[model samples]
Target: MSVINYGQLLQLAWPEIILTVAALIALAADLLFFRQSALRTRFLVAASIASIGCIAAIFKLLPGSSEGMLLGGVFLSNPATHLVQIALLVIAILTLFLSVDSTFTDHVGEFVLLILLATTGMMFLVASQDLLVIFISLELLSLSVYILAGFDKRSSRSAEAALKYFLFGGMSAAFMLFGFSLLYGFSNSTNLVQIASAIHAVPLNPLVILAIVTTVIGFGFKIAAAPFHFWAPDVYQGAPTPSAAFIASGSKVASFFIFFQVLVIGFAGAEGSATLHHFQSGWVPVIVTVAVASMLLGNLVAITQTSLRRLLAYSAVAHAGYMLLAYVAHSEQSLAALLYYVATYALATLGIFGILTVTEKQLGNDKISDLAGLSRRAPFLSACLFIFVLSLAGIPPLSGFFAKFLLFTAVLAVSPGSKLLIGLIIFAIGMSAVSLYYYLRVLKSAFVADPPADATPIQSPMLLQLVVGLLAAGVVALGCAPDLILNQILKVIHASGL
Candidate 1:
């Protein structure tokens, strides 16, 4: 034996450790360097450098060593971890942009700490191979997000959002804990792989089904899938735009990854045949209903909204529906579609929200009509925003179209007998078509309408704009190079067998 040691675990978690250490370094740098508000641009540059360095640590895992690579079996660095970590890194960069103009310079160091802490929690959450560890990591992320969401303590809505989030989030967590207890009882194991094997070995009973349902609902709350989604709009509207962006991108995406991990690795092994044979019928309907509801609610409610920020809030909820289209699919094809969709969605959403935060400052709280004829004032800025909106609307050649198409095609492939799939496909197509109306409404206001006589087109910082460029390019590139992106998803899927 080559003396199994702690060093292996540390190596596995090097990226997360690097990020945490960087955050502390940034904090000390802020304290030491500041005679006045650390020069915004200079401080931001440093922070960006540190954040990128943190993400670079993730690159080490891309070559993926999967022989129980971390924590002597307590942790893992399998292909699933690789793909999810990549997603997490991309979202972290987006958060950097989202906060660049918000509080990065003034309270410069503190926001970075919060972001890193939250992200660290996410890293642990995804890497965890046991339910107990996953729960602990989840709380770490949740507590950090709860605070961040209400960082603007002066705002009543921010406070209210935090409270509402806590209540609902807490309730869901309780259900999750209870479900975990039931699962531990039934399967006699907390280790995800073993529990999954146990569940798969036996027919899924009422208790097992309850455990699964409650667990889904718990994660559902995190992801803003409907019924559990009531908190998202209020929270998004109330939270600082940057925090909202992180919450929207990082929190949901991380939860999605964990939800996926817990299910696939916990209960979806080969023995999963027995469990899946029973649960698929039950869960599919519920997922479809939530998905359809989210789409309609998001798009329909968004039309009447006057504020651009609020509209985007609803738009995020609707987009949640689109993302869920991948999950409702009970097959690997749908999952690969999901992987592609989320990757595209992550970059595009981050870019759009990053721009939103910047412009909100200049335009003074984005109202739809206020955006009248934006192209005339800042054609470039308007064009960038247009690209984002078009992507959101699923216009072809943009990443959004490809993501939607992949999801639809995947779902369609699984549609042979399930009437639910047929109905879902129709709903998905109709919803896609219906979304054009609201997205176009924004576009028309941008290009066709007249600019506000007083307001000028806002200019974005070069780095932030560069980030936007990267995301826009990513959106298109993902569409054009579907196989490349899909391949990573497939490998992860194969490893996890989701």
Candidate 2:
């Protein structure tokens, strides 16, 4: 066995280390201020410290040249991983921003600390190249999120969300662990690179197929894909809005990153090998079926939703389908598209949730109808909401449109002559069109519908407004000039030699 190199490992893992230290510091600060009368000030201090830590972590992550495998090849530092770490950190910072004056502000230090821990987990998760590392990192992320989901002790809905999430998440973890065990049984290894090499030498077996399907299903739950997405709407509706945003945006980015890594690396076989062909044949069909179901079901179900949070939850399911298109294609370009799409999706979704949080605070509910006459009362907020909603619907001149366009284009590029892929593209287009109706429904409530007699202007904190405005601008910028980010993603992919 190769000896571990401590110095190199530290360099590769600096971001995670910084984040962990930051979380501990935040926790200590929380304890220190537990009895303080200046509750809001304590929360602000914790948030500020966490934000500084996140910024520091980003800097640490940015210095690398996307080279090196650390800790005996269990962790990798590449351009793709760096980019994902940056996105996760940004999402954490945004979550911190939303936490101020929100539901969990009373427990702000714990909130910031949990976000930091989750961010740390995701950083490790995206960089992980071994099953053991993957499982541990995933748990770190999930456990933090579970607590954050139920942080509001006074709300039974929050408790229910946590319980359901925990139960479902536990089952998924079991399935994934069993599947990983199967993989180890076949390959005698947990390291993905070694597994790929080993699988190339082993005969394809029934257990291999089972492992692939089960593992995908496990990840399917993580990404909120259809048939495994039952836990999302309730959790999003019940959890504090910032927690929901973290789960939806930050968690998703990390999940997809790891999923892509596992698929592209672990089961990949030598060219022309039976194992490669068998793996693809076994997994692609399953992915395509899930994608089709997710798109159709998510879009169709979202139309009937009255609560804005639930609507976004279902919409997230559909977006997962769109991202799954990248897996089906399984090429470097497709992976780039996936990364680009999720980044844009996270921006819009987080912006929407931030606005929703403010609205919920002022109106005491997140019903779509509550946004009526928002244009008259808070034009800036309403307009920002309109932009985010339109982006989500894949409307022209918005980031979501370009995201879908790139995804579909990558799909077509991989198999231009395949009639089945063409049909899938068409179906995806139809679903996008269907999604517009619901998105527009919300926009109509915000912009066109008359306010009730008691309607009053929303008084969002300036920080919230700044956060949403920046996200809105990011959505528009990514829409209009996607290459600004896409170019960087392609560079990362190229550097990784994918």
Candidate 3:
């Protein structure tokens, strides 16, 4: 192992330091200008803008750089780190836009600060090569989210959701830590690189199996993967809409990065050196089982939901399942496609939820039945909703379709003979069909039903209207020209060597 170095640590932590400083400066401004809500709101918006600007700065700063492990191997600066940070930045920008007219009014400054902190933790998690770093970053992200979930302390439901989520999240975190302990015992190393080398240098033991199995369960809960996804629906339904959007997009992306990094990078053969490389077939069943059940449970349960928020919660779970199939393919095409899918999904989901938050404030309920005949009442909002739902359904000529199509084609190229692969593909096709029923159901209600005699016209903000416009255009643009994104994703895949 290389001796400890201070310079590399600074380089690795610069981005995170920038974000931390911004949050402190913004919070100080909030405290200094104590009595004026208008001034506070304006400054809060400015702080969010500055935070996003710093994210852009980091993007420009880190793309081609390589600073090895930092914080004694806790944080890192590498090409893959840059990719995950970019995704987090996108989600942060979306959250800022959504917060403008939402219920984050009373504590906007604090909320914005916490959002930046949550993102900072996520960045650390993606680059962490040590168990200590992973555990710290995980708790950092989770604590911020728990408070965000219960931000509306006045509401019992929100408080209840936060408590329940915290309990489950904390328990899973403990499990992960315990597994890491077992791994450390087996390998005599806490660093991922060292642990991997040790794994092959010695024999696999009971502690090794326990470490891998238990850690998967821990991360599965974090990503809301099947069997570990029980907390999602309730927490999502209870959190403030913008908070829900943040968790749905940011947490999922960040956690998935760490997940893939663990399986693909840590488990991969060493740099330019040959060993018994993985066959990958062993991972297929675990992923396939999660994918099938997530699709069946998330989609089927969503069909019975009257609450739009609850429906979206399940829909996100189903999407996770779909994305997992691409991972199972274990090819460059699939990896590239997964990144594109994540980017497009983040933008589309944030835009859709932005509108939902706006309309909920104007109409006060997120019930699908309450939204009956919304087309006549608010044509533009209804149209935007239709586009998003269509995209979610993987309808042709939308980004979602390309995302699913590329995944299927990639899987076919790699494992054409396996019955498991065949079954998964068929299940994907069937689930797509099953998904259409629920997706189009919302559209049919919007366009075909009659507006209530006493229904009121929804007044949405211009900013939200613009977000929807961009998302709708993006869905069509990405779908028609996936090659535009394919190149960027290809860079990411090659760099990660996944």
| Pairs of colliding residues, candidate 1 | 196-266, 372-450
TM-score winner: 2
Q: Write the per-residue lDDT of candidate 3 for residues 77-187, one digit (tens) a residue.
A: 666678778778767866766677765446666877888889888888887878888889989999999988888767777888788889999889888888888768766
Better model by lDDT, 1 or 2?
Answer: 2
TM-score of each: 0.90, 0.96, 0.91
- Would you list the C-alpha lDDT of every candidate in the order shown? 0.74, 0.86, 0.75
Which ranges of candidate 1 are over 4 A from the true structure? Answer: 1-5, 39-46, 64-73, 103-105, 200-203, 269-281, 415-417, 495-498
True lDDT of residue 491, candidate 3: 81
Clash count for each candidate, listed in order shown: 2, 0, 0
In candidate 2, clashing pairs total 0
Q: Between the candidate structures 1 and 2, which one is better when assessed by TM-score?
A: 2
TM-score of 2: 0.96
**Ranking 2 against 3 by lDDT, winner:** 2
Name the TM-score of candidate 3.
0.91
Model 2 CA RMSD to the hidden true structure, in angstroms: 2.5
- Which consecutive 10 residues in model 2 have the weakest lDDT in total? 270-279
